[model samples]
Structure formats: C-alpha cells, structure tokens
Target: MVYALTTRITLSTYESFFRIVRQILPLNYNQLTIITDYERGLMNAVRIVFPQTKLQGCWFHFCQSVIRYCKRSMNSLFQLFQTSVEAATVLRMVLALPHLPAESQINCNFTMLDGFQIIVDYVNQQPVIRERLQAFLFGYIQDFWFRQITAENISVFGLEFLKNDINRLLLYKL
Candidate 1:
C-alpha cells in the first residue's frame, strides 16, 4: 500500500496512482476509510476515484498543522499559547474539538450561532487580550478547518469503538 514516487505530488499523479490501485486491489470501497494527512491533491484524488469510501484527516496532523499555522501567522498568539496557562488551555480546547460529538445539535435562535458558541462563550469570559486571541483562533478555525476540511472529517467522536472493533476483527482474521 506504499508508493515511492519520483514525480511531484499532484492531482494527476494521485489520480494515476489511485487508478492503478483500483485496477490491482479487490477492495470494498464502501467499507474503506482512508485516514490521511490534509493534502488537498491526494484527498481530491481519493474522492474522485473512490467516491463511496470515507475519508478522514489524521488528528495528529490536523493539530500539528493548526499549531504550525498559529506559529507562522500569529506568532504573538503562539507565544501566549506557550507561556500562558489560560492561553494554552484555550488552544488545547480548540485542538480537542475533533473529539466533540459530531451529531450534537445546539438550539440557537441567533442565525450566527452554532455549536462553537460554547467555545466563544468561554473566550468571552477571558480578558480583552485573550478575546483578541479567541478572535484569531475562531477565524482560523472557520476559514481553514471548517471551510477547507469538513467538521465530519475532522471529528473522531463515536468512531473509537468502531476502530477498536475493526482492530479486533483484523487480529482475529490474522
């Protein structure tokens, strides 16, 4: 299942690779869940080739990417994240978002409100400086995570048990 490619990783390259994989493997695409890092080209190719398969971004990669982004784009905030316990906690909460129940609904009368309101509410209670930090974090989450990668793909809630069961089944089969 590993490919050592000399060519640059691109949509065409991934598409060609996936096409060959489809030809070679007797895979049940419907039952397949591919967990990969957030690479748009590879993800898009997988979606194109195996539309029925579930695609999930690796949680570790997601966290690393977010932290790296914070460090690069908002260094002051990143510094605060490292030095301040409160700031660290908020960032940790943001990172833990993928563990939230994906199916939970928050009843809100306001058009702008959603499940993330809880995070906002917590941020609002913090000092004004922290509020600025919250704004940056929220904007980042909204623009990058929510827009580019879907919440469903990011969230791992309720999947741990299924993953465990799958692991058990694989062990038994082996």
Candidate 2:
C-alpha cells in the first residue's frame, strides 16, 4: 500500500518513506519483495534501513539500466553486441524474472551468485563504472544481491560481518 508521497528525494527522504510505511503497517517484513526503479540513493537507503527485504529491480527500469550500463561499461563489445536489439534480449530475460515462482526466483538467485565472478572480472577490467557509481552498485552486487541465496557460501564471498551487525541495528528503528 502507498503510505506517503513527497518531492524531496534524498537518503533522508527515503528513510522517511520506510519510517511512514512501518508506522502505518507495524509489520515485521523479515521477508518482503521491494520492486523499485534505478534509484540508487533510495536503494542504498532501503538496504541500510530494511536489511531483510528482498529488493528487485523493475524490468522496465532494468532495461533502461542495461542501456545505461552499456553506455557506461563500453568496451569492444558495444559497437556490435550492445545495440538496442541485443539489450532487448537481455531485458526479456529480466522480464522473465518476475513471472518465475518463488522457487524459481531462489534458483535464479543462486545462478546469479555463480555468475558474480563475471561481475568481478568486469569490474576489474572497467574501473570507470566503479568510480562513477562510487562503488554503490558494485558493493551492492558483492555484499547484498543474492547473498542470502548463497548464505552457506557467504564465507567464501567474505562479507563484512561488522557491517551486517550495523544493518540489523539500523533496521530496528525502521
């Protein structure tokens, strides 16, 4: 349910979104699905304030992001493989994500975990995106995205246990 709406869009503004939502609902959303556009500021704020919620990227926005990411993450591939048609193919895959049942989503999450090595390689090769995002998306992919699906292998990913503790504390007031 929509709780509040305001024009101010900042980290603090997003915190208020969570605050108003919780005050209205009074529910423990240890498991919840949050579909959002490519608002990284709000996304990070949500991650900080609601550690348990599973954040999913909107398919439309994700398609836009593919274009954005392609522009930002260009290499030899962009002239050929990064055309709009190719991006549509990728968008189609992302569009399929929401249709999958919960069990399939979990499996896809695990599959994403396996593909993270590709992300690591990409980051290593393309430092510009890392610097541009200020490590936000990179850190999100490394630390939060699909980690719960691979909780058993978290140690291999070498998460910041201290940061997780801090997230739990931040979650309490939200």
Candidate 2: worst-modelled 10 consecutive residues by lDDT:
151-160
Residues 24-47 of candidate 1: C-alpha lDDT, one tens digit per residue: 897888998877778999899889
Candidate 2 lDDT tens digits, 57-127:
54444334444554455342233333445333333443233233333243354444334444455445554
> All candidates' TM-scores?
0.79, 0.44
Kindly report which residue stretches of model 1 are placed more than 4 angstroms away from their true locations once superposed. 1-3, 105-115, 161-174
Once model 2 is optimally superposed onto the true structure by TM-score, how far is the C-alpha of residue 164 displaced, in angstroms? 32
Deviation of model 2 at 17, angstroms: 1.9
Residue 142, model 1: Cα distance from true site in angstroms: 1.3
lDDT of 2 at 5: 69
How far off is residue 162 in model 1, in Å?
10
The residue-level lDDT of candidate 1 at 54 comes to 92
Candidate 2, residue 22: the lDDT equals 71
